[model samples]
Target: MNVAFDKPSPWQRIQPVFQGFDLPLVFIVAFLCGLGLVNMYSVGFDNGSRFFDQARNMLLAAGVLFLVAQVPPQRLMALAVPVYTVGVLLLVATALFGLTKKGATRWLNLGLVIQPSEVMKIAAPLMLAWWFQRREGQLRPLDFAVACGLLLVPVALVLKQPDLGTSLLVLSSGLYVIFFAGLNWRLILPVLLAGAIGITLIVSYQGDLCQPGVKWVGLHDYQKNRVCTLLDPTTDPLGKGFHIIQGMIAIGSGGVTGKGFMQGTQTHLEFIPERTTDFVFAAYSEEHGLVGNLLLMAGFLALIFRGLVIAAQAPTLFSRLLAGSLSLSFFTYAFVNMGMVSGILPVVGVPLPFISYGGTAMVTLGLALGMLMSIAKSRGLMQR
Candidate 1:
């Protein structure tokens, strides 16, 4: 019954794995990963498997990091179109024969349940970056329009699936590629102004305008309810408004120093909904308080800033566009999730990047970081 304990040779053990290392990108990912572990611990204490699952996810992410790091940025660019095409086909399949949950069809089944929209998150950026690379020195209005078309196709499909959060993420990621490709600010300024005006109009006349059959054409009923809930959580405190009210209460109850880890009354009392998933932020806030929240935000900011620096230093247009879009996409994920949980934004199901608990999201984020690492490592190699 003796087990083989003999260790393999050093090269056999390490050569395939550690053949190439991107130090800066690896450090940034490891730091964010450490923060995710802490946040998961805070929210997942009573849930026996979540902590272990998170650890397993981290290992899987590291493996992704290694695999993607080995690929050159040019290779990723070359794979962009076929990858994006496959992703779109999957999205179409999801719409046709997908699994529906909570009234939305967002996942496809091929022996395993998978979310096709997550693939678009990566594909959108990759595809746009590839487009920009082709038109690098000759980027023109038509090229920008084509890039927009690339973004709009997947975004429209996702939005049709009625997954607003993911649709926005995909849209924003593609827009980041456009911005990085030297888009005209004159064109962007008008859109921003119009958006601000639209927000003002919505908030000003929300009561009458949102009272069913309003002029707003795109928003779904549940989406409208979430916005209304954000405006005034007390509107239906015990029904559709329960999530925001409880989340705010949990966050406020944390006070200055917090109730300490695993000691949060609201969380342990089971008042917070989605405690281990989208609203994990509220649980973390309740346990860690303002000080802890600030620390968490600071860690996120550091990661984003480092990512942008990597993007800025990337040698090629494709690498820069890909890195920049991925970096900003991370920012969007944090902002949207925190804003929703804090009642400042509509409740769209955007996970808080690495911190929130979900296997698909964690893997998508790992893939993004791997892209950034690929860009960073390429730049490092070029400089040498």
Candidate 2:
């Protein structure tokens, strides 16, 4: 008797590709991406073929998420050190003979110019998490010191690149790793208090500190300008403040329900700066209004909450720390961008995550989400 079994259909064969995919996380991401595309169409209608290009970028990001999710946490842990080492080496090389544009030496010209700091966004947390996991039960003050040293080296290098946004991100990523790895709140309280006091002092002495020829300590000229502009944008209305002024105007002009999609005067008239990039929140605010803003915030909240849940469920310390850091880092990116656009924080040129148009950033975000998916998937596999 020759009995031939039927081959599994292609759908069945490929179905397992998404077998452990987190449905809620996927929905949240897709929802945010869809909203992003809609807003991009409105903001970039006359900015060339950006909408199509963004569509392509989204596809690319989706592909990255899928491909990366396939890698297990054990494998990711294995790659952490090498990835971080290479990233740091690239940053050092950039410092030596890197490409510079607009006075910022941030890109590496290895045939195709690339920003090494962007890679450190993921690498920093990965390396820190892996380190903490190795010392798991044997963690000591010295171990924490070593971990902070690992983190600061890359962060300082990125800052030397003069990319404050990336520096803030890398800093937060590593901090989250430490925080998750059992850093005591006794230590956290002092830092938070110091930050609060510093802000108070800055606000109190803004007039004196922001005077022409009065140099602010530690901050670069442009960095000082950003803080001063945030304090009082009218001080440099037509110069360094134009972007903030335009952004605030768009956000306020949206009223309660917005001007109705693509109906924003500030957006269509190009009154908003960097409409499709750093100031995307302004364009989105102008077109979508409060209702749209609420929905967008809701999407981000969902993503953040889901990430924490995944971290809570992670089967290993490495997964938990890395997932938590990446998730909170996403929230930080959104909150900082929104705060800057609304004139409450300094304009550090960070994009609005999924809603902004940029291939490189989107790819980074995809890698982040992929890591989260891998954690979720690993949990599922162990359950089975």
Report the C-alpha lDDT of model 1 over 303-349, residue by residue, as the tens digit: 78888998888899889889989988989999998988998998889
Tell me the lDDT of model 2 at 38: 95
Where does candidate 2 stray beyond 4 Å? 1-3
Question: Worst 10-residue stretch by lDDT in candidate 1?
Answer: 16-25
Candidate 1: which stretches are off by over 4 Å? 1-20, 213-215
Who wins the TM-score comparison?
2
* Residue 217 shift from truth in candidate 1, angstroms: 0.2
- Candidate 2 clashing pairs, residues 3+ apart or interchain: none
lDDT of residue 91 for candidate 2: 97
> Per-residue alpha-carbon lDDT of model 2 for 1-384, expressed as tens digits?
999999999999999888999999999999999999999999997876999999999999899999999999999999999999999999999999899999899999999989999999999999999999899899989998999999999999999988998899999989999999999899899999999999999899999988888887767888998898999999889999999999999999898999998798998998888899999999999989999999999999999999999999999999999999999998999999999999999999689988999999999999999999999999999999
In terms of lDDT, the poorest run of 10 residues in model 2 is 210-219
How many angstroms is residue 320 displaced in model 2 relative to the true structure, after the best TM-score fit?
0.5
